[model samples]
Target: MAESTTIEYLCKFCRAVVEVFGPQYLRSPNAEDTTRILAQNEAREFYGMLGSIDCLHWAWKNCPFAWQGMYKGAKGGCSVCSNVFAKLVEGHAPPVNFKVNGRQYNKGYYLADGIYPRWSTFVKTISNPVPGGKNSYFAKCQEACRKDVEQAFGVLKSLFAVVRQGPLAAVDHQVPVAWAAFLNMRQEIRDPQVHQELQKDLVEHLWRLKGNA
Candidate 1:
């Protein structure tokens, strides 16, 4: 057999490692994980929050002509959500019970921005919040915490540049694994009613936590 080029050999090695350890390490959060996430978020006045959510854009300049449309966003650039984020969305959403203003919520949430849908899992910053009000305070805290999500994305990308740089063939080979593991992308994540309720609770919760201080 002919010897593979450096990039080809590296791709093969990376593929093998991902195949073996991806399921174990790339896996979703569990009960213990949620507990830790909750404690950390609660310290920030966001009870029952798992983390923040946001997507970044990358220019896939060499994207296939036929696939460019799919990759293109409104501004004509490619946007990709982090793989770890996919795991969280498709992963097991444990019942994270918590109370705010005497109201209870069962599922955890992520601090997002206006671009995202108003889903139960996403707690977006209040837009144009009235000055010196609970909404203003809540927006301040939520947006501040949300800033960390992008930094985390940067760190992950730096560590896993291979996954982003692998040749088309290697990426194609691994895409199926992600799809196969997608248990409930839509049903589990989209809950508008719950989102509204959760948002209300959070606004009140944060206001009480810091508004008076």
Candidate 2:
């Protein structure tokens, strides 16, 4: 016989669905546990820097023009997308609440392209650069931080192949936000460590590529 979807099963399914497609999805599946772990890890790796920020576009099956203004592509495409801004911090060691050591970040800042706002929390890349001066400490750090956001989006797209395909079936405009939340939850549960490692490795790899190019 086919299995029944009972309330207990439904609850679990809803939780999973929310965990996969709701706002605050990242905080759903044992968020306390994952956040603690991630905060600790980020502390060790980033010397207290939080996470990265970037924009992503998701197709809106029936989106209106007003919403489209916020969904511009990196190369000026008119696709419907959501601009996600995230912070990745180091994982603090055990028993300390795993809260980010924000003091270390007082002097440090996050890197972004021209899209993000100029907040005290984030640092934007140089809109224009002097010739032969692209290789500087500040430039390198900015490049490193910006790459984290790109890699985070990359991993998200890779795992949730549906996101890579096209517009979602849902009619609600908030569906993309829900999808982002779900992806965040999955990241929290399954491969937090993998992302941390990838972030670290990508910085070195990109630097090498820049040098070669």
Candidate 3:
């Protein structure tokens, strides 16, 4: 089957799977279940968080340059990127409002970089000169937290290899939507415990690299 056809087939399969197995198969037992598991595992294992939020860019095969402006990267490129906002909750599952209309919510009072707006729910790093002219701790913390979102994108791209390469056909926005749904569904099927562990490892690894640099 063509790539597009394959995606359509998988989407149908996912809908059928969810119907047969139930939505519980794609989520935690309940919000409380999320809170407890996240709190226990993330605090003990990861040290800093339960998750992070960031954005990912995918080429829009036939999107107009005008609309593409809305999809540009923070560095000023006309690329199609999806804003993904996430966070880790200790003894708690992550937020229930994960994605809204394919755009991740920019909530929480955590750290982020300049690219994101400084909402009451988020803590963005500010560049301020110190009396002694040393690097700002606030800046460092922001960079660290921001990395979580970046790493999340990396993992998603790696797992869903299709995303790493190519322009999604403009004919079907549903294709990408289904693809994201599949990714989320796959994460659920693999178990939250395992997903939490993977996140913990990735955060630690990224932190180490940031430290070295």
Best by lDDT: 1
Identify the runs in model 1 with alpha carbons over 4 angstroms from their true place: 1-3, 55-76, 82-92, 162-189
Cα lDDT of model 2 by residue, 1-213, tens digit: 335657668668756775566544332113465455346535434332334544345545565677657765566545553322232221211122221222211222334566654444344555555544433433566666558667876787888755565423332223333556656543542343433343344344445555786
Cα displacement (Å) at residue 63, model 2: 2.9
User: Which residue pairs clash in candidate 1?
Assistant: none
Q: What is each predicted model's overall lDDT from 0 to 1? A: 0.69, 0.45, 0.45
Model 3 per-residue lDDT tens digits across residues 48-87: 3334334445555566777866766665545653332221
Q: How displaced is residue 60 in candidate 3, in Å? A: 4.5
Instruction: Count residue pairs with overlapping backbones in model 1.
Output: 0
What's the lDDT of the predicted structure labeled candidate 3?
A: 0.45
Each candidate's clash count: 0, 20, 16
Runs of candidate 2 with Cα error greater than 4 angstroms are 1-25, 28-48, 55-61, 77-110, 131-136, 161-213
lDDT of 2 at 60: 53
Off by over 4 Å in 3: 1-11, 17-30, 33-50, 55-61, 75-107, 128-135, 161-213
Model 1 lDDT tens row, 6-111? 7788789878877887655545566777798899878877888777655334447677878876766545566554443444444445558898778877667778
In candidate 3, position 145 carries an lDDT of 52
